[model samples]
Target: MNYIASITSQGQLTIPKPIRDKYSLHNRAKAIIKDTGTIIEIRPLPHRDILSLMGILHDNPVVKANRGKPSQQIIDEESAAFEKAITDNVVKEMGLPPRKK
Candidate 1:
């Protein structure tokens, strides 16, 4: 489908909904836009899942050690909930079917 879009004064152009849907570019998806001399190219960046964040906190000794924590259990529970939220968000953003419990 060919679409003619107007660029705003802010130099921003809205990608048509059909194209966004086709490329799974919803929910603030990142993309690479470049002028290839002959043609302009727009490609959606790869989507990362929660598992990819593993070891992200390793460098943060305070958080990694879990030291000076009074309620480790509560922290663990909240972390689990946060992980679930991240997973759910990724699924929703990618327009994938919800995971079964």
Candidate 2:
């Protein structure tokens, strides 16, 4: 899954479509790009609590619809999903089976 892409004059690198599709990276998705001494690593940032608050502040329709403090059940479900996503990515990177998203 190696790809070579050119950086634009504006200094923005376009991630390949296959990688974006595989990671479910939508428009304006957040990612962390780190210089890891020997190599560079790019990791997508999952939508978290703070991002949810930001969404609410910006009047995101979905966030606005679910306004107010979340219940324990909802919180638990989101946590579970986030954990599963991380686990799935790790397994995939290790060339394991059963991709779950």
lDDT of each: 0.86, 0.81
Deviation of model 2 at 31, angstroms? 0.3
What does candidate 2 score on TM?
0.49
By summed lDDT, which 10 consecutive residues of candidate 1 come out lowest? 61-70
Q: Give lDDT: candidate 1, residue 79.
A: 95
Give the lowest summed-lDDT range of ten residues in model 2.
47-56
TM-score of 1: 0.48
- C-alpha TM-score for every candidate: 0.48, 0.49
Q: How many clashes would you count in candidate 1?
A: 0
- For residues 14-79, write the lDDT of model 1, one tens digit per residue: 999999989899987889899999998889987886677998987897676664666877588779
